[model samples]
Target: MKKLQLIGLILVLAISYQCKDAKKETQETMSDEVEATEVIVEEVVDVEIITFKMEPKSESMVQGEVTFTESDGMVSMSAVLSGLTEGEHAIHIHEKADCSSDDGKSTGGHWNPTHEPHGKWGAVEGYHKGDIGNFTADEEGNAVVEFETDQWCLGCDDENKNIVGKAVIVHQGVDDFTSQPSGAAGPRVSCTGIIN
Candidate 1:
C-alpha cells in the first residue's frame, strides 16, 4: 500500500508538471491570441446578474438576494419581506419599481401592466400585470419571497424593463382587489432598490 501511494503521488506530480508546461506555452503565445481566447471564453460563459432586495413591513427584518446562471437561463430577483404575519398577503411589483430611500413610497402603485385588479393569479382570467400573488408566512411569521421576471434585463447590453427604478411593497393584509389601482394593503414599511 505504501509503494502504491508513492507511485500515485509521482504520477500526480508528473501531470502537474505537464500542466505547468502548457500554461507557460500559452503565456508565451502572442498577446493578441491570449486576449482573443479570453474574450471567447467570457462569451461562452453567458454571465448574468440578478438583483433583489427585501424590506420589512413593520418591525420585522428584511432580506434580499441576486442569483446568476441557474440552469443556463437568465433569472434574477429579490424580495425585501420577512417576519410577516402567519398567512398569505399580496406582494405587487410597483409600477415605479424604484425603492430609493424614504420607505419606497415613491414607487407609485401596484404593477398593473394589464390594467386589471389584483388577486387574479390562477384564474383562467385572473392575474394582474403587477400581481405576482400572495406569499404565505409560516407560524413564525416569516416568509421567503423571491424576485425573478423575464421583464428584466440581465446586463448592460441586454434589454431592460426599467423596473429597477421601481419598488416592491409587502401589504400588511391581503390584496382586496376592490378599489381601482392598489388594493388596500395599508402602508409601506421597508424598501430597497434592485441594483446590479
Candidate 2:
C-alpha cells in the first residue's frame, strides 16, 4: 500500500507539470499573436483627400468640382466640369487660393514653385508644377479631367511640393505647350481655391 501511494503521488506531480507547461506555451503563443497584430497595424498607410468647387470666371460659363487625393506620396486630381465649349481646354494650378476676382486673375500665374519655364508637363525643357496640360469637352459641353503625379503634396512641409493655398484654373483654349509664361491657354474660364 505504501509503494502504491508513492506511485500515485508521482503520477499527480507529472500530470500537474504537463498542465503548467501547456498553459505557459499557450500564453507565449497569445503574446506572439498580439505582437504580430501590432506589426500589421503599424504597416497600414494613411490616405488624405480634399475636394472643392470651381466657379465661372472671365465672363465664361465654365463650372466644375475638383478633388485631390494623396496616398503613398502621390497626388491625384480629378475634375468634373460643365458649360465648357465643345472642344479642348487647358487646366492648371495657380499661385494663390484666392478666387475672389471677377476675372479669375486673383489666383495669379501658374504655380511654379520650381521657377521652371512654362511648358508641357514632364517636358525636358522644364515646366511649371501646375502645367496640367489639356482635356477635351463633349459635344454637350461637359468634361472630366484626371491627373496624377508624385511631385505634389497637400499641406506638406515642402513649400515647393505642397499644393495647399493654391488655385485651379480652367482656360478657354488648348495649352500651346510652347508659349512662354502660361502656354497661351487663353482666358481663365473657371477657377477654384485649394485650401486645407
Candidate 3:
C-alpha cells in the first residue's frame, strides 16, 4: 500500500510540472505573435509627410519651418518658430498662398471655404476651418506648435477643409477664441504656404 501511494504522488507531480512547462511555451509563442503583428501594422500605416517654410513679415523677425503629417484620415502639424515675444500668439490658415505683402495681408483673410463664422477650433458652432487656436512663446523668443485635427485635409480634394496651397499665419497677439473675422487675433506676424 505504501509503494502504491508513493507511485501515485510521483505521477501527479510529473503531470503538474508538464502542465506548467506547456503553459510557459504557449505564452512565449503568443508574445512573439503579438510583436510580429505590431511590426506589420506599423509598416502598413504609412504616413504622408508635407513641409512648409515660414517667412517673416512686416519687418518682424518671426520665421520658422513646419511639418504636417497625414495618417489615418487625420493631420498632425508641428512647427518650430523663433523671434517671437514672450506671450501667446494666434495662428491660422489663410485663403491664398501669396505672402508677398510686408504685413502678411497678401495671404488674405482666414481660409473660410465653408463660409462659416470665425470661432475657436473645437467650437460646436460657428467656427472657421482655418481656426487653429494659439501657441505661447518662452522668454527666449521661441515657440513650438504641435497640434492634430481631423477637420483639415492635406490634398485639395475638399475645398473647404483642404489646407494644401493655403497660407499659415502666426499672429502678433493671442487668439481670444471669440469675436468675428478671426477671433480678433490681431495682425499677421509670420506667414507660410503649405505644399507637399
Candidate 4:
C-alpha cells in the first residue's frame, strides 16, 4: 500500500511538469505571432498615382489643353492655354473642379498646395500646392506652362491626403500669397477634375 501511494505521487508530478512545458511553448508561439503582425504593419507601401482631365467651362473661354498622367506613382502635368486676355491668371488646383459655371462656384477655391494662403504663384511653400502661377495669355490669349514638383503626389498614403478629391482652378488674376483668401483673382475662369 505504501508503494502504491508513492507511485501515485510520482504520476502527479510528471503530469504537472508536462503541463508547464506546454504552457511555455504556447507563450512562445504567441510571441512569434505578435512579431509577425508588427512586421506586416510596418511595411506600408504605396506608389503615387493620379489621372486628371479638364475641359472648356463657360468661364474657360480660352482654348487650353491640360493633361495629368501617372506612372509608377509619379505624375506629369502639361498645359497649353490660348484665348486668355494678355495678362497673368492664377492657375492652380481648386478645392473642387466641378466647373458647372463661370462664377467658379462649381469649382471651389485654389489648390493651396502647401495649405498656405494665396501668393504671387512663384515657388512659395504653402502658397498653392497646385499654384503653378501666372500663365500670361498674350494678344492671341495664349500661354503654355510646364514644370514638375513632388509637392503633389497622388496615391501617396499620408503625405498629400486631399489631392485626388481636388480640382484645378484658373483665376482671372495673379495670386499674392499674403492676400486674405483667393488672391483677389476676381473669379475662376477654368477648372478640371482629377479622377482615378
Highest-lDDT candidate: 2
Q: For residues 73-187, could you state the per-residue lDDT of candidate 3 as single tens digits?
A: 8899998999998989999989898898999998888998888888888778878888889999999989999999988888848876689988999999988877878888777
TM-scores of all predicted structures: 0.56, 0.79, 0.77, 0.61
Ranking by TM-score: 2, 3, 4, 1
Clashes of each: 17, 0, 0, 13
2 versus 3: better lDDT goes to: 2
Q: What is the lDDT of candidate 4?
A: 0.66
lDDT of 1 by residue, 68-159 (tens): 33223444454544566678776776766566545557777766555554555445645555665667777877666675555444333432
lDDT of each: 0.60, 0.95, 0.89, 0.66
How good is model 2 by TM-score? 0.79
**What TM-score does candidate 4 get on C-alpha atoms?**
0.61
Q: Which wins on TM-score, candidate 2 or candidate 4? A: 2
The lowest-lDDT stretch of 10 consecutive residues in candidate 1 is: 63-72
Residues forming the 10-long window of minimal summed lDDT in candidate 2: 39-48
Winner of 1 and 3 under lDDT: 3
With a 3 Å backbone cut-off (N, CA, C), the pairs that clash in candidate 2 are: none
Pairs that collide, model 3: none
